[model samples]
Target: MVDRLFRMKTKSIFVRLPLLFIFFDAVRCDYFPTLYPRESETREIKELNGLWNFRADMSVNRSQGFEEKWFMSRLEKTGPVIPMPVPSSYNDVTQDKSLRDFTGWVWYDKEFFCHYHGKDRGSYTGTVYWMITTNSEEAKVQVEVVDADSNTVVMGEGIKGQASVSNVKLWWPYSMVKTGAAYMYVLKVTVKDSTSASTDIYRQPFGFRTVNKTNTQLLINNKPFYCHGVAKHEDYDLRGKGLDMVSVAKDFNILKWLGVNCFRTSHYPYAEEIMDQADQQGIVVIDESPAIGLLQQVYNLTKALDPTRLVTFASSNSNPLSDHVMNIVDVVMVNIYFGWYQDTGYLQTIPYQVPPTLEGLYKHYNKPVMVSEYGAETLTGLHTSPSFTFSEEYQKDLLIQYHQEYDKLRHEYLAGEMIWNFADFLIDQKTNWAYGCNKGLFTRHRQPKMAAFTVRERYQKMINETQKYQN
Candidate 1:
C-alpha cells in the first residue's frame, strides 16, 4: 500500500454560498453546460472530496429543503446533520440502519478554492465538471459554484458540462508536463434545483486529458499505445462498492509497481475521484457500463462527450446482442472463457479460440478487435504437479496461453488485451472457495500469486518489444 505521505500541493479554498433568488417555474430546463477545454488549452480544476453537509429525504416528502435554498448553504433546521463524504454514494456511510437504505433526495455541499482575480480575468473559463456513474432516470442533479460572499458563480445542470470562468489555472496530468504541478480550483454542486422537486448531488476532483484511438492502437497525449494492464472492480470487503480514497491510492501504487499503463473499470464505471486520479497519473481508462445490459444509447451518450476516445459495449457471456453491439462501437471486444468454463480443452486449444474470434469479427466489421477478458480461476496458494483446475500452476499456464497468442496477433488485427481481473474480489457466498471469484492474479488483499509473476514477466517483455515502435 502507498503511504499517505503524498500531500496534494493544492490547498482547499473555502467559498461561501449566496442567496440568489431565481424565479421558480413549473417548466424544467434540460440544458447542460457544453463549454470545456479546447485541444490546445487545459483548464483549471478544484477537488471537492472532503466533508459536506448531507440530508436524505427518505419518504419523498420534502419541498422545504428546496424552497428554503438548502443548497445555498447548510440547512440547520432539517433534522440531524450528517457529514457526508463527496465522490461516494451515501448508501454505505452511516451506522444508522435506516440511513443506509434511505435513497430519496440526497443533497451534498462543500466549499472549494478558485482564483477569482477580480479584473485581469482573461478569456480563461472555469468549469464545474463531474460524472453521475450510477443513478436513476428520475434522479435530478445540479451543481452550483458560489463565491465566498454567497453569490452564485457558475453552475452546471446535468451529468457533465463546464461553466465558463475567465480566470483559472490549467490541470496538467502527471508525467504529461515535467515542469508544471497539478493545479485545481474550487467548485460546488447542488441537486435541489429550484425548478424541480427532486435533488441528488455529487462532488469530486475533476480534470481533462486527451485520448484517441487508431485502427490498431490507443493513444494518450499522442503517445504510441500499448496497455499492459488489467481490468478492475470497485469491490472491497466492508465498503462493498463505495468510494474509499485509501483503497484507491493503494491500488494505484500497485499499478505503478506492476508497470501497468492502463486499466478498464470492469463491469461498471468507477467513482469520479478514481477517474480524476487516472487523469493525474497518466493512466488510461476504458470506462465501461454495467454488465449484460449493454445499452448503445447510454454508451453513445457517454461517447458524445469526447469523440476521440473509444467506447465498447462490454459483452461477457454469449449474448445474442454481441453482433449488434460490436457494429456500433469503435472497437470489437468480447469476454471469452473458452478453455476454462465451457470449452474444457487443453491450453493448446486456447490459440484456436482467440485468433478465430478476432479474425471473424474483423472480417465482418473491419474494426480492431480486443480481448477484453480471458482467465481461469485458481485458489491462492493452491498448486498441482501436472497442473489442474483451481491450481496456481494451471492459472499461470492459462494466462501464458492467452498472452503468447495475443503478442503474436497484436501486430495484425488485435488492439489491446486486458486480463479478466487484477485481483480476487468478493462476490456472493455461493461462489467457490474463498467465497469470491479467484481468477485474479493477486489475492483480494493484493497478495501476488504465481499468475502475477507470469503476467509481469510477459508484460515486461511486451513493453520492451513495443518500445521499438514508439521510436
Candidate 2:
C-alpha cells in the first residue's frame, strides 16, 4: 500500500482554499516566512475568502476521501456537500451537533478565476531588514527603500548591502510615550534570472524599534514599557476563529477605547490582516506559537530567526520554582489562577498566593515577570452583592485583586499583566464551562460586562501614568 501510494503520479489540483494552505514548492528558504502579504508595483495578492464546498470523511476508516482522489473533482460530486466559509473552523458553523463535535478528516474546495488589481503605498522612516528567497541562487536581487509620500528612493539600490537611515522615526506602542507613533516604511524587492527570463517583484511594510528587557523592566526604545492589555483569541459569533474584518475593526477600536497598548496572541499567531493593523496602530504584540511543549527548541529557533523581539511562553504551571524552562525564556510569563482555579471562592487568597510565586521566579532567574493569564469565569447579567464565583461582580473583583498584587511589584520585577481573555470565546462542551469560557471582559458578541469597565478604568489610569512618566 505504501509503494502504491508513492507510485501515484503527481497531478495539478486547483481549488478554492484558504491562503494559509497555499504552498509554492518553487521557492525555498531556511527561515519561516513571517512577512504579511502586500500588493506592490510588481506583485499582487488575491484573497480567496468566501464560501467553499466542504465534506467530512465519515467512512469506517475515515480514508474514503483520500482514497477516491476527491481533490481531482468538485467536492459536491464526490459526496453530499455543505457550504463552509474559508478561514474559519468548520466545527461551529452548522446547526448539527455531530458536525459541531466532529473530530476527523474534513475537505473544503472552491474554484475561482484570477484577476489583477492596483496597489497603494505608505510613507515612514526607519532601519528595515529584509530577506528574500529565489529558485536559483544566482538570480540578481535588488532592494529599494521608497519614500511613500514623495515617491522617491530614500535608500537601498544594491544586490546585497546594508543601508542606514539617520534620524529614523522609531515605532512605539500606543500612548507608550507622549509623542509615540507607529511609523512604517515600504521596502521593494526585485528578483531577475537571465537564464530563465523571469522577473518577480514584492513589497513589504516594516517599522524600526528596539525591544529589550532588564532584570526588572521591559523596554521599548530605551524606555520602560508596561502591557496594560488582555490575551485575545481569534474567535467570534458564528465565525469560530474565522478572519472577519468587521470584527477586527471593532476590536481595535475597543482596544484603543479601553486604553490597551499591548496584547498577547494567546496560544497561536493571529491573521496577517490583524497584524497589519497592530503595526499601523502601534500596538505591542507578544506573539505566541501554537505548540505547547518543547520550549527550549522553540525559544532557540525563534530567537535565532528574529532576535529583535523578546521570546517567552505562557506557562500554566502553578509552581514556578520547579519549571525547568524558566531559564530559557527572555521573560518569565506565568498563568496562575490561584483564586479561581486553585483556592476556589477565596478571592482574598490571591494577594497571598501570587506574591511568593512571582518573587521566587524573579529571585531564581532575575528576569522580568508577567502575569500572562489570570481571570475568573463570569456569566454576563449574573450579579451578586458580595461577589461570588461565576457572578459578574466576582469576575470584576478577581481582576481588581490581581491588579492590586501586580501594582505592589510593578516597580521592582513585575513587567506586565494580561487578563486571560479579551472577550468570551467558544470551546468544547464541558460540565464546568458556562456555554463557553465566560472569563472575557467582553461577551462573545463584543458587548462589555462589568469586568470590562473595571479593566478599562485601570488601563486608562495606567496609560495616564505612562504618559506622565514619559513627560
Predicted model with the maximum lDDT:
2
Question: How much RMSD separates candidate 2 from the native structure?
Answer: 15.0
Writing each residue's lDDT as its tens digit, candidate 2 over 1-471 gives: 000101112222223342223322332223324555565784445566645667898887987877896765667568776556565777755545687788778887765433333111124345666566678767877787754232434556446566766555667786776553776766877787866443777767777788998999999878899888899999998888888755676687678868889899977889898888798778899887865677777877887888866888888874665677778888988898988889999988888888998998889888999989999998999999999889999998988898899999999999998998999999999999979988999999888899888988899899888888876
lDDT of 1 at 136: 55
Best by TM-score: 2
Backbone clashes under 3 angstroms, per model: 12, 1
| Candidate 1 per-residue C-alpha lDDT over 1-471 given as tens digits, one digit per residue, 9 for 90 to 100 | 111121122333344331222222232223224544222233344444644556665545655567656665444345545445555665655435677677556655444444322122124455455665434564566776654244555666776666764454444433233322244443555554456744443444444334566776665545546667789999766677787765675577567556566689987778987887676555668887764554667767776886565777656633433455667778777788877986764887888887777777777777677778888888988889899888999888888888878878787878777887998888878735567888887887777899888787776666556554433
Q: How close is candidate 2 to the true structure, as a TM-score?
A: 0.72
Ten-residue stretch with the least lDDT total in model 2: 1-10
Against the hidden true structure, what lDDT does model 2 obtain? 0.76
> What residue runs in model 2 are displaced by over 4 Å at the alpha carbon?
1-126, 147-153, 157-159, 193-198
User: What lDDT does candidate 2 reach at residue 250?
Assistant: 64
